[model samples]
Target: MPVVPPPVFALAAGIAQHLLAPDRPAGGARKLASAGIAVAALGLDASAVAAFRRHHTTVNPLDPARASSMVTGGAYRLTRNPMYVGMAGLLTAHAVRRGGWLTPLPAAAFVVLVDRLQIPAEEAAMEANFGEAYARYRARVSRWLPVRA
Candidate 1:
């Protein structure tokens, strides 16, 4: 089963298509190059998470339907929300690569939708199921960024 809703996936696919589409650079070469690098990095990170997921079977976000074991290996060691962070990174990179005054709107919309809708529901379910374990993990791992401390 897919993790994200079909509409969310559609929006993500559209943004990705826009990012990959060829166009004359309205923005400078430097900005375009930076965004391309960012997108590449995001893709690499996402691949890493996918590899980890394939290797381990204990990283489900849906608590009621989660695996019995907690995953602490691979990308989970760096952050609790690696998959979501990867998705956000991809969206940000897509926005930056697009390059316009309104370039960030789609990324902002993604953040709002995930934060306001998906994450809250997931967190509540996690909290109910995992209790202190989830809390401790949250305290350690940054929500959509790597933990600095």
Candidate 2:
């Protein structure tokens, strides 16, 4: 649960937006992407704030000493890690906007880091804390990507 530096998120999101800027359509696609990013970012931010308010938020590895309640509101309805997912989406939209084929690297790297490192550690801690409930939730939601099936 180590928080990524805000600057890193900002830089990645900026790059992504830049990449996707070119493809930003004048109509539907642009509107949809804009709305999507806004909503996702809002949800993530809200959850993060809630986590902070509850004094359960941390960027370091999940420590029971710092553990808080499991948040399942707002964007958590769509994805478990809304903040991470939202950041990734911002990066992706940038890539799409820029129309840069190479724009996927940072986003992909972000995914790998979150999935392989942050998420697994968080999940383990959640499992230890919440037991079966966390497992069921994990079964229901995909770690980094939304499950289609």
Candidate 3:
């Protein structure tokens, strides 16, 4: 079977969130905050994509071995998987706007699935290609969120 894309999982999670929460129309401030979060998350994803393009590397998640260079700058400096972070952020924004207790479940599930099933292989490929540089990057930066003391 062909591998399903991460964006597809993100989309399904969004749909599931909506079904669970049933988004209510937000007031002015809430609407603005949600939009802001979504735009920032999109920008994070865009910066990661731009970094890949700048390095002349492939952004294809399915084929991590094809990555020509390591991307440790831009949004990558924040999280090794900015695209996944952006998707989770978007889902979080949606959950905030929707305001149902169960709304966040799908987003949480999406993160867990990606972390468990997707990241290990990608990390292996990165280590195989970039070796110690990738190891250092992984050690310094986080797999998902950047948590600092």
Per-residue lDDT over 68-93 for candidate 2, one digit per residue giving the tens place of the 0 to 100 score: 56665555556777667767776666
RMSD of each: 4.5, 4.4, 1.7
lDDT of residue 94 for candidate 1 = 61
Q: Local distance difference test, per candidate?
A: 0.62, 0.64, 0.87
Stretches of candidate 1 off by over 4 Å are: 1-23, 26-48, 51-64, 147-149
Question: Rank order by lDDT, top first?
Answer: 3, 2, 1
Candidate 3, clashing residue pairs? Answer: none
- Model 1, 22-77: lDDT tens digits are 57554676477657757765775666557656756444444324644455556676
Minimum summed lDDT over a 10-residue window in model 3 is located at 1-10
lDDT winner between candidates 2 and 3: 3
Clashing pairs in 1: none
State the displacement of the C-alpha of residue 142, model 1, in Å, after optimal TM-score superposition: 1.1
Say which prediction, candidate 1 or candidate 2, comes out ahead on TM-score: 1
**Residue 41 in model 2: lDDT:** 65
Residues 21-61, candidate 3: write the lDDT tens digits: 85477778767888898998899888888888999999887
